[model samples]
Target chain A: MTETTGTNTRVICPKCRQELPWFALNTDTMSLCTQCGSAIRACVFPALLHTHQPDPDLPVPVAEGDASCFHHAGRKAVAACEECGRFLCALCRINRMGRNVCAACLSRQKHDGALPNLTTERILYQQIAWTLTLLPLLVFPFLAITAPIAFGYAIHAIRQPPGILPQRRWPMILAALLALAEFALGLWIIHLMLDDMA
Target chain B: MTAESPSYQPFGRSTLESSLAYRIRHRLFTGPDHLLLVRQEGYRETYRRLYFRDIQAVIVRRTVWNRIYAAWLGTFTLAILLLAAVLAVKQSPPPAALIVFLIAWIPGLGLLINAHRGPTCDTWIQSAVQSLPLKPLNRLPLANRFIAAVRQPVESAQGTLNPAALQAFATDSAAPSGRGPETSSTPATDTATIPVLPFRPYRGHAHTVLFALLLVDLAHSLFRFHSTAPVMLITGLILSIALLTSLILALSRQAGTRLPNTIQGLTWTTLVYLVLAYSFHSSLMMFRLPTWNHSSPASLLQVLYPPAGTSMITTSFLVLSALMAGLTGSMGLVQLYRRQSGHPPPPPSPP
Candidate 1:
């Protein structure tokens, strides 16, 4: 797999890491690997043709009468941080999804998970709530203990981030209604049991 | 979100792998600038972003998971139908048999759906960072659509390379270079230029041991069926333990290694056999074992070994076990010999 990123944008066979012929790449037809003869279909994009350029990190020295960096007074300001409105030098500026942000603002976004791009993982509260409501139905008696908890969880899940793509509210709504019904049934059963005891 | 920020559209969704315990789902979302891979496992979701400008290639390799899934479902459905037929012949209630027949339809429908989806495949996206599987594109049709959607944006971002340039780069990459030919190189260019290293092929010591153990078990099964002596029971127990250890060793060792196709197939066959054998034997034990209490350690011995010369089910089970072991063990040894004798191995099977 690492061989795919070989010297001059070489497209290798996925199975064997053997370099594919130029004709094998970007073709609609199936191609066979030269070494391990595994059937392969590949689409080589233009990114393979163009090499990536690393951004320059060294800051330029500040000149007289020029706007200096907020973090480093001696360095020239290249861009303003999108979040904090602070002037940032080349080294201090972190270009993320076309936004020039300072290290501090970037770290803050990462910690707060305010930016979707910065979030590596998220908990799907809606799924957890749905599972809570549905799984207890197998043992009906447990519904008395779980119904209110499920309803509460569904309400709490609404304020959290749904998912990367917007989540549908219908499933959560259905779960809440079911929980309510289960709670009512549980209350009736408890009342009947208490009456018999009395 | 800024006005200039790219808007994303849903590309495709696929269950990458699933079992009884958990399932990992992959959903691809495409934006003008990049493609996002969101993987969901239980309540947690993780993200991987592959920029169009960084994506080098999209590769699709064929796999046999589709066929394997179909076979499993078909076998399960057949077994259920057979059981239902047996119950009907025994004059079981119509509703009882009907219920069993209806249950078979679940896996029957699953088999039909699996077949309809066409062949399975493993799709990978090679980027500047590392090559990772694009699980959402697990089928050829899905991969085709994904490639079509991604190609235009990527080409527009970085200009297309002509055949002549591609060929030149292929030749240049095959040999060696200081910096890449046409494109502006990065600091990592030097590392990418390193020659491809040779990989070691797997030596099948575990496989040999497993085959040998299977043959030993086959012989032991026949011997234990003829004699009811205490020594025979002890020997049977020891053989069972050894066979189980070898099975585990062989299965684990073959994973991620380039083993011959014949050996791989044999390993899988043995796995299927073991699972079936265990299920049947455990059910039989539960049905026949007299004492359920833990207080009687002596009666528990009957659960381990079906009483010899007692029942038709025990005799038939032992016979079936011996037959399977003998056939598989012989086949394994022949395949191993063919491999050692310089015969060309068959095409590699998908894991």
Candidate 2:
């Protein structure tokens, strides 16, 4: 286990869905859930199987997601903590973002925090629509930059789509591939046009 | 094309084969064994679009030249002999016998032509009837059907049996043994079958022995007038009939291919016919009664062989010849009738 950065705390059991007491577990310190007695992992929520509550303080996990060095907390905030509205010091928290959050407020946050976004499908659709319109007209170089950028914000706009929606991912992926082919052909057309001009 | 697509498809292989079989049963023409009948998807349509319109298809195979020649041989001999007899009897010398011989060519060529794109010929009737369902024909006596099946092919061939099968019968008594007892119980037993001694119900060789009877009649003619020329011709005709019948059976079957072709058999038969007929003419005159011997060669000829007796003799020869040929013709036709009519044994009691 890493040294306690006062921000670390314990949270509920995702498997049994039980609320747990503080200090009951740590990254290396093993224990069980007080309510259900399920073996508890000291690892923060997303890192382990089963989902815990989303962070109330930070924006929902963004596209630029990673182990963040929280300057105020001193512990690396690998996941956003869901409890108190602050990036906290290690000893003051419990596990969040699969890391320990400060001991206090883990249960309060588990009940109150909002969840991660689910709009990947909407983003995927909008990007496909954008590319289909743009790629045919010799505009791929411009389309590539704008579509992927907008794709990010669009993906974050809603909660995660029902897991079932991934079935539609294949056709969209196929569309994306066709778009790539069209982009290449479009470039070839432009090259020919330039050759004719010269 | 669009309608043909299966909305729901069968998943098994045999199911597909059964479907194809069902299609064939509904669509294809089936017929007696000799004229090759084949069922295929595109061919029937192709034929319909061509040589014939009403028929789905028509296939033709011409009679082999030798069979045609044999047919001509029978018809020519019968016609010429009859014409000569008629002229002599009428006391008017009509056209020469050679012209009559030439005229006989029509029967050999014309048996089938009489039907003329129509269905009067029993060959077509029998052929077509063989393929139809046996049920509707329930009114036909079982005996009739049996006789029809066995005799049909032979009857159609005139006196000739299928050469290959009959000769095999001559050489090997067991040659045609493999075909069932049912085939045996019907028709002029194809002498081509190899006799399976015990199982073969003794059918007297009544058909084949008719030749010997012809020879004896020729011999009686020789002793009566004792004319060498008449004796020779009579003997020749008798021997020719015997030899042609046997050898045609042999040669046509082409069974003893190692020995010779039908042409050789036919050639020898024809030579025998000519020689024996020549010998009979001279022998009959030479063997005439002693009292008829006269002074001059002309008187000697008349006295020895009186014109009335000669006419009677010629008429007798012509009648006998026609009778013999016609009888053989009926025998073959009857045999053919029996074959097509004969019922196969009730499906052998399941194992």
Candidate 3:
């Protein structure tokens, strides 16, 4: 676990992005940002044991027995990329998903959008499911089209991971079930109409 | 900071004062590093311990009703003073009128103090995922101190005091596969980047408008504007309907949103009360029930009690309307306050 000494802690203002001393936050009421004049409410949490430090992309020494970085030949290598076996300097090495990788490999994964750790934009399947399942109810006939779609989306959501925040899976499940029921009801209505026409 | 420390210092204490029972139901103990929330419920004691490091945020929210109440009290005081002045100008002022003026000062003074103290805010501590509410703190100072105590260790532990170093550290440790480093990010930022929390914009505007209408209607009644009763009734009915519709829209728009149970209860109660009051008042007015002289009471007894000539039904409707107006007005004030307080709405329930 990484630990930083707490003697010099500062919080970034959400509004202005100005770094404010932790003590400057008013916990009782909304604190005004000196820079932006925006009201802020600070929710203080326990500090993480580990602190992140930036690595300087320095030139590698030409001395014998010194390993050079795979990406930057001039930089001294600190560790080998766990993913691709490439020697990486402190600046080129990226720790993610419990493994260290070189800049090239990290960039490749991000470009491909294959790595969950690199994912910033997410499809909110729950919102989609909710919109499909409930919104169609306003126009009762639209349920015939939307219900199946809602069910399909809800089922699809199960295989995918939830958003960055923790959430229960029950809503999706319930939505899927309700959509299925609506779809079935629509089908039954269609069958009844056919029988009446016959 | 450890749990076993004999010198555990508490920054705040919440005691449930029950006259009928000698039971200590809720107690909050804060140490240098941890907060312990204890609840005792009839032979069962439950304890929840939260370390300062794990707490993500402490949310303190206050409703506007307290300020509204204070304003109402101030108006009441002023009205009493004006009435006293009017009485003094008379050839001989009644002793009862003087007594009423003197009696009003007690509540007026109490309300002024309450207003000066500010609203009793609801406090909640947000950890990683769950938010735990402390007993609602009444005094702003006490709430501030409690928050300071909880946040101090966390702030110190996080080492956020030195921004440059922390930023450097953050950049150095940035996961290459994750989002880009924020070390060079300037203070001037766009609001678009901020995550949009679940919120109902203009959520309480309908309620506020409805309350304002109710207040206007009350004033009309007090002034005995009989000819305008129909107009007030129609306006009240329309606003009440609008209020109900807006409330439904709010609920539907933010499905599975969790508000404090007390707030939900208050909202529902005020709605029901307003509906009943409106119905009764409108009915009585339509039937042309005799109106009382609220401004000029024949005696203190007449002022305190219902007039003898008025039917019991009329009296009841009048009284109920008055009570509901006050209750709903306060509720609306609270809703308005919450809307203005700048706290992000609670996160929607997960699907």
Question: If scored against the real structure, what TM-score would every candidate get?
Answer: 0.71, 0.19, 0.41
Evaluated at residue B161, the lDDT of candidate 1 is 62
The models' CA-based lDDT, in order, is 0.75, 0.36, 0.56
**Against the true two-chain complex, what DockQ does each candidate achieve?**
0.40, 0.00, 0.06
Positional deviation of residue A104's Cα in model 2 after best superposition, in angstroms = 86
The residue-by-residue lDDT of candidate 1 on B182-256, one tens digit each, is 653544344344466543455777888889888987898788767766677787778778878888988887765
lDDT of 1 by residue, A34-108 (tens): 565566888886667666566566899999888999999999999999989999999898898788998888777
Query: What is candidate 2's lDDT per residue for B323-345, written digit by digit as tens?
Result: 44443344443543343355232
User: How well does candidate 2 score on lDDT at residue A157?
Assistant: 25
- For candidate 3, what is the DockQ-based docking class? incorrect
Give candidate 3's whole-model lDDT: 0.56
Indicate the DockQ of the complex predicted as candidate 3.
0.06
Error of 1 at B324 (Å): 8.4
Candidate 2's displacement at residue A125, Å, is 75
Best by DockQ: 1
Worst lDDT run of 10 residues, candidate 2 chain B, spans: B45-54
Off by more than 4 A, model 3? A1-39, A43-198, B1-5, B8-10, B13-25, B53-65, B68-95, B98-106, B126-130, B136-139, B150-160, B165-351
**Fnat of each prediction, in sequence:** 0.58, 0.00, 0.15
Tell me the spans in candidate 1 whose CA falls farther than 4 Å from its real position.
A1-24, A32-37, A54-58, A81-84, A93-119, A132-152, A161-163, A173-198, B1-8, B16-23, B76-106, B177-180, B183-266, B291-351
